[model samples]
Target: MNFLNLEIYLDYIKDNGYRCTPQRSSILSYFIGQKNRFVTAKSVTDHLQNKMGNVSSDTVYRNLHLFKDIGIIDLTFQDGESLFHLKNEINTHEYKFICTECGNTTDLNLCPMEKMDTALNDYLIYDHKFEVYGVCPSCL
Candidate 1:
């Protein structure tokens, strides 16, 4: 689901049993403005404080996790810090090669799980995340 619209996002939150608080709306708006780029939680908290006045980092972190849990955002770790971006599509599965040097990401067309079906025959997999980490050619 594309939540670029604040109203659509707020409605989603309400539909999912969450309150449409101003802080949550502002957070989603910030991510919407960022498009698909990943951003640090500190940056999100700073934006909230500057835009909404006296917002707490703890509150921001809590909501960020909540958003991720509900699949509104995607999360990754870069240099020991958590980074997040709004998920463009809810049901699409994507694998990516991530650059450790610049935090850049490139989508991979192949799904590794396709080759592991035999090994996973006894397992019931509901979901998975796949990422390859290395320096991009530009950084290399």
Candidate 2:
């Protein structure tokens, strides 16, 4: 995530009345500060404890939930393990391409919602859920 983008997100959170504790700021800073491939609470806690000294995993988890609630990040999971990543950049639509064998996920450029929107108008479905699972090329 870009520094400017993160500053804007934190501003949005502050405008809505979240306290923005130092731990929260540091947690957000960790996510925004790095360019990482999906991450877990333990990974973040370990790095932070090195910097802040003696932080708890519970604190990390709490901030993770806060970030999710305010839309700064998105949650993904595999094999009963949770991973967090800065939210994918916005676009006309979003797609996740998942590989079962190797347990990898890649973002796709196509926007299914365009066609789906047209069909939904006729069918009048009020909501949608989009999750597409398939083997990525490497796994194939």
Candidate 3:
């Protein structure tokens, strides 16, 4: 396990007046271990439960929300379900293609928002999220 990645999350919680508990540690470790992939709360909960036993889905969701609040992760909706991915540390902007058939994600380099700049003028935009869904090649 990379202690540095875990430390960053622990330090963030500490700086924000939150205690670092065993559960929170495990959750952060899981995300760090599986970086660059979107995962559902049930998947996380099940994995932890198999090893630790008694890990609840609610606990996972609550911790996920905290992580999102701290800007360490971002959420996307697909097929009526919520999926999570770590916030990009380098480039914060990129549109994504989400595969509905297999839940795969592909980042697109082009920014469609660029074309909307002229049409969206006069509107103050603090942030934006863009994700399109379809069957991936392998899934198709």
Candidate 4:
């Protein structure tokens, strides 16, 4: 993945009025440099502990909240726990599939549900909750 995109996200938050601190930048770099989306605060802390020395869970939570506040990322309570991922990286709604057995996520490229976005906006007047679960290739 291109770390430059993460930098863009940082610039985005700044453009929206938030200061990008070193710890926050490290956390964002960890997220962007890593391949997994199904990650937790503990994992982030562990990853940062190696190079950046140590960081508290509070710092992780606070920075995550800041990312969420700017809409560059989003959090969800799925399967039984919290999950976070960049909004723009959230493949199309139809492409979001989660594997319950392995917790792996796959992004499909087909555009079959392109119309659903508008339909949901028209009927719900905002948007509708849409998520799907299935076994991923690795799990299956």
Top TM-score model: 1
lDDT (10s digit) by residue, model 4, range 1-140: 22337678778878888888888788778777655455666777777787588778788888877777666655667657676665544222334566777655665556544677666665653333345677777877
In what order do the candidates fall by lDDT, top score first? 1, 3, 2, 4
- Candidate 2 accuracy as TM-score: 0.67
Regarding TM-score, does 2 or 4 come out ahead?
4
**Model 1 stretches astray by more than 4 angstroms:** 1-3, 101-104, 135-140
Best by lDDT: 1
Model 1 Cα lDDT, one tens digit per residue, 58-107: 99999999988877777888778898877666435667777777766677
Per-model lDDT: 0.81, 0.67, 0.76, 0.65
Which of the two, 1 or 3, has more lDDT? 1
lDDT measured at residue 28 in model 1 versus the true structure, 0 to 100: 90
Candidate 2 residue-wise lDDT, 3-94, digit = tens = 32656666767886897777777776777655534577888899789889989999999888877766666677766888776654521123
lDDT of 3 by residue, 45-139 (tens): 98789868898899889988887877667788766779887655422654778777776678777887788888899998877778887888998
Clashing pairs in 2: none
Off by over 4 Å in 4: 1-4, 89-95, 108-129
Q: Report the Cα lDDT for residue 112, model 4.
A: 44
By TM-score, the better pick of 1 and 2 is 1
Residue 66, candidate 3: C-alpha displacement in angstroms: 1.3
TM-score, candidate 4, is 0.72
TM-score for all models, in order of appearance: 0.81, 0.67, 0.76, 0.72
Q: Tell me the deviation in Å of residue 123 in model 1.
A: 2.1
RMSD of each: 2.5, 4.2, 3.6, 3.7
Model 3, TM vs. native: 0.76
Clashes of 1: 0
